[model samples]
Target: MKKLLVIGLLTLFITPFAHAQFGVKGGLNVAELTGRDGESASYKAFYHVGVFYQAHLLGPLSIQPEVQYSLQGGNLKSAFTNYDSQLHYLTVPILAKLTVGPVFVEGGPQFGVLLNADQSGNMQVGLAEDGTPAYGNVSRPATGSFKRGDFSLVGGAGLKLASNFSLGARLVAGLNDINDVQNLSGINDPRLQNRVYQVYAAFQFGGGK
Candidate 1:
């Protein structure tokens, strides 16, 4: 299975370079966390930057594979505290695109390797000696709090505004639980999965229809 997986990845990377349009992409990400039982975390804003190679397959069909750096997470708010979880990932998305005139729609699977994670905020730690509650600013490494691998599905549409530039929007839904820590000091949630919406611009180096 490992050998097959490596071979597949190699094919996806190598097949596009022969006759493909290379581009750079950057985007705004609105990310959140969702639970298995319908609970949700507050939305947090983040960003992603990447490069892609789009290989024309058929008349109006193309395959695009991208490598990107993405920051994704969610916010948890209480009466006295606001905790934000920041997750950094190296992500790859393999997409199949269909173009109709100036509009195009794409959908595919995305795999992410977690680079690191951290949480920052002011939250309640414990009670003070005088029978009063105490709060402190917390900033610490949280890489152990999440799973190392993230698998997701992405779908979106865009317009070919010009030959070299395009605008697009996409939705990403996590397929696995990312939370590795069950109960933490500030927040305790069930089955954390990523939910993100992205709006981006793609700049293709060699322009074409």
Candidate 2:
């Protein structure tokens, strides 16, 4: 169903703007979490790489479609626990771009399919008499606990750089819950949505009609 939607929309957007340009990009990702209760997850380091198409819809406006492999996650620390989880995703974004010569701004919706999720950290049950975690290390497998699909709103602006090379940045905020973690075992929470700030550079190769 989602796949069909993606294909159908891409065709609709691409067909009208047949004179599109193809490009490749890669960049840094600063990611964090929001919405979950009691979770003070901080921004973590990650990366994203992808390819995109820019189709001119009008004189100064265009429609862009992108496919990306994004590595996104967060760093979480509590009094008795600390860990970092790495999430891998295949993301597709369809953006409406407004261009003014060398400068442009684009905003759109993105859909992500989860590829994998892994966690590395230490967990503890209770503090020792000295006020330290009794069980120092615990492994939490984030698999099967997180949703397989994610949805986000993305917006950004950039320099077109002579129509060949470009530099840009964007923010992506999760609209759907990535993880609804709650347990009778005092385990998880529902506010594990993804938030990422991405800065990238792209090189244009092929020009479309």
Best by lDDT: 1
For 1-209, candidate 1 gives per-residue lDDT tens digits of 99999999998777645568999999999998777332336999999999998998777889999999999998866666777889999999999999899899999999999999989987666778985668788998889989999999999999999988999999999999898975444345547888999999999997576
Q: Per-model C-alpha lDDT, please?
A: 0.87, 0.82
Error of 2 at 165 (Å): 0.4
- What tens-digit string does per-residue lDDT give for candidate 2 at 1-209? 99999999999876755777888999999998766555468999899999998888778888899999999988877655687888899999999999887888999999999898877787544557976446566555676657899999999999977658888999998998888444413344555789999999989776522
lDDT of 1: 0.87
Top TM-score hit: 2
The clash count of every prediction, one per candidate, is 0, 4
Can you tell me which runs of candidate 1 are displaced by over 4 Å? Answer: 1-18, 36-40, 79-81, 123-135, 182-187
